[model samples]
Target: MEKLEEQIAHLTRTVEDLSDVVARQDQEIALLTRRVALLLEREASREAEGTGGVVLGDERPPHY
Candidate 1:
């Protein structure tokens, strides 16, 4: 009976630790998902403006 109790306690602790790790991972995944969505939105806006390929700080092309 004592060994069984010890085993149960150990298992409980392990589960709690795993749960915390999973929770943190879930939060990180949510943050990354939001970042990806924002980047995609910005890219779409740039494409709509016809300047998707324009690098930053570059002068206007000769055609301009």
Candidate 2:
């Protein structure tokens, strides 16, 4: 009976640890989803303004 109790305790602890890991991952995924949505909105607004081309560092403008 004592051996059975020990096994049950270990299994419970393992399950709790896994639950914590899953909760943390869920929060991270939610944050990333929000950031992606914001970026898409910003890109859409830029396109609407007719500035679709992005100028990189030391890059010449299209008119140059």
For model 1, how does the per-residue alpha-carbon lDDT over 1-64 read when each residue is reduced to its tens digit?
A: 9999999999999999999999999999999999999999999999999878865576776577
After superposition, candidate 1 runs with Cα above 4 Å error: 54-64
Deviation in Å, model 1, residue 47 alpha carbon: 0.4
Error of 2 at 7 (Å): 1.2
Clashing pairs in 2: none
lDDT for 42 in candidate 1 is 99
Q: Rate the local accuracy (lDDT) of all candidates.
A: 0.94, 0.96
* Residue 61, model 2: Cα distance from true site in angstroms: 2.8
Could you tell me every candidate's TM-score relative to the true structure? Answer: 0.80, 0.81
Give candidate 2's whole-model lDDT: 0.96
Angstrom error of the Cα, residue 34, model 2: value is 0.5
Residue-by-residue lDDT tens digits, candidate 2, 28-59: 99999999999999999989998878789999
